[model samples]
Target chain A: MAFAVHRPESMEAVIAALDGTASVAVSGGTLAIRAINEGKSFPLAIVSLRRAGLAGIAQDDGMIEIGAATPIAELVRPDLAFLDGVIASFGAPAVRNMATLGGNLFAPQPYGDFGVALLALDASLAIAGPSGKRRLPLSKFYETGLASNEIVTGIRFAPPAPGTWRWLKATRRALNSAAVIAVAAIIETDRSGTISAVRIALGGVDSHPVRSPVAEAGLLGQVLDSASATKAGEAAATFHPCFTDTYASAWYRRRVLPVFMRRALLGTPLETMP
Target chain B: MKSSYVSFTLNGEEKELLIEPGRRLVDVLREQCGATGTKNGCGQGSCGACTVHIDGVAMLSCLLPAELVDGSEIVTIEGVVRNRVLHVLQEAFLAQAATQCGFCTAGMIMAAKALLDCDPSPSRQAVIEALSGNVCRCTGYEPIIAAVLAAAATLAKRPAAAAAA
Candidate 1:
């Protein structure tokens, strides 16, 4: 149960430390520490990402680049105001200070709202492993999982135009609770208020953050409204085979998905919607 | 596994120890340094009882590896007192009757202290967000939230009074 922790200070050092060894990389240590205490099947060696030169935010051209190890607290800045509500909806201030964007991608379902947001943003991840460095779409990373020694180095995404990104995390409690149904979408409406392009991503409904192609397909050319939002939500829920746990049940999630989808698009509460 | 020498500033004092690799910061603070002011309600990070400040940010000490914090400055509940006087947040907690069972008081005070240190005037919603990770089984969160807001008001007027005896 005891493992030696290795703190590598540079990208090269971190990449070299992952030499096909049985080690787990820890950033923030919020999730890993819990796993360790619970006596679950975990790695014998921990490579601390604390000193791994993977913390900061920068913008190049239209792309916003975030270091994988940057704490969630750092991301809640005024410049990135769209994410303020989402990040604030996560764990309390203490947990946010200790949780990292990279760790959220690896956190289990119902726990990674940031991942859902990134998927909605069409973010790309820069990964390093034994072979070399490669960039892949965030969704691809979800499907392929990680190579044995690979570590997610950073994420890059072109910022969506204003009024395009929408996120809502439905939690039983306003804070510290897992998502009942977390939804994020990037939708562009024409001057006539018809949907031009739409990408919808969801959390807490699947094993990993996922895109709701069915929902996107349902709303592409329609004028977004309560009715269209309801239909799109239904399409998305049909694709989500929700699982029941202590937080909520599958039936409860299915009942609320339509309401949340309407809220995400129409910006109206379920009760207010016609 | 070999024990490693971990060094960090604890409650403004430099500390070094040959500690087990899996040792958590909360255990080290309570067991080794006898700083029991930081209670452990739930060994998991869900309960804010093990909250502390690392490099000036409030974090769950239970989830931090003692080795990872080497050379970092840490502040626990014990560090909130200065010059034999309670921190303003603590004073406000007492004034607002925020303690019932007292198990979660230390962590709540530490969490509120961290919030006030960063934002002198946190809104009601902000206070709720800051202390959301901490759970109080008794005397629900309204009093605690009120206490934090009051402390912010007092600290804003006499900023240095918190450390004065």
Candidate 2:
């Protein structure tokens, strides 16, 4: 048996117990529990956020608020219909069923697909720790490793009205593939279908999920033409590449950056897809 | 470590047991609860052999702490049947010849049941998405897909029947 302690119930209890001693905060356990069972350790006490009511989605004032414990599987349910493509790109059905938005943030892997999507949208994380509530940029949560002391309660974001989102993950196979580089972008197209504002976020390419401001700046106000798409792709790939257990080397990622960039900028929507 | 007390509803029955905190839901079901229909394979979370429905959602029993189930409702393969008759899904599985080796049959049934319970009428894409996490080495997937589709058709017809009645 794995050595552990578990509480199914509350987030406050989970947070209170997280003294960074024996207890660890868990959300769905897709990444934390797996790592702990495999002998990875940041804490001995395992406080589950399963019963924390963190598994809900609601939109208020144009901001989509996802409960920390909300499973990625639940993200596609009509409430989160706008980000359908983003959630489906997380992993296999099982992984998505277990992986939570909180866990993905807590997981701290640079290749985390969910992280890529959220960063592009400028998501804000709601965290609870010994000191109490703190709201920060979603990217600020990582600090070289998992923050056992802090428990992430949820994330909130206000997406652009009538916008376009595109998500692409580079992988060798369907399930459990290491993300070489996962990309997510939101763009507003003008009446003539030219680009107005473009935001691009990339993961598995850096130590943390980051927005390519340079890419966004370069593409903003630019006509949404094939040449402009090519320029955005090149700008997005300007960051040095990183690798994990998945497909594509640094060179390969750089080579494929333009393909995803083009699709993210100019791709058409499919009536039915995964 | 010594065991503690836990109380949860398993397949419509409220039960309590004294178990080790380290014990997973699969261990509690198979050993403490004496429901061997919940098999244990790859005690890790990767394999679907220990899959179960907690609060109507499919999760890995092996990774779930036994104590977390306290107050939650659970369903197992043994409970898949209804009124002394096999569930439509089980019947469809047999009719479509979906099981081979049979080790993974129970977990697959549980996984499929969770999907059907939520959405009786599902698209082929939805069915495929639900079972993509389940792995079966013996029987090719075409048959299982057939079984799920058959079950979906059967399940989809019931609401109309109820409405008409």
Best candidate (score: DockQ): 1
Evaluated on chain A only, model 1 obtains a TM-score of 0.96
Stretches of candidate 2 off by over 4 Å are: A1-12, A77-79, A108-111, A143-148, A173-178, A191-194, A269-274, B156-165
Instruction: Provide the lDDT at A247 for model 1.
Output: 88
TM-score of chain A of each: 0.96, 0.88
TM accuracy, model 1:
0.96
Top model number, lDDT = 1
- Give the whole-model CA lDDT for all candidates, comma-separated: 0.86, 0.74
lDDT tens digits by residue: candidate 1, A162-216: 9888888788986778899999999999999999999999987888899999999
Candidate 2 per-residue C-alpha lDDT over A148-234 given as tens digits, one digit per residue, 9 for 90 to 100? 567777789886465577677766655445566677888888898777877788876667777878678878888886778778778
lDDT of 1 by residue, B1-165 (tens): 788999999989999988898688888999988899998767668999988888888888888778888999998888978877888888889999999989999899888888777788899988998888889989878999999999988977885764441
Q: Candidate 2, which CAPRI tier? A: acceptable
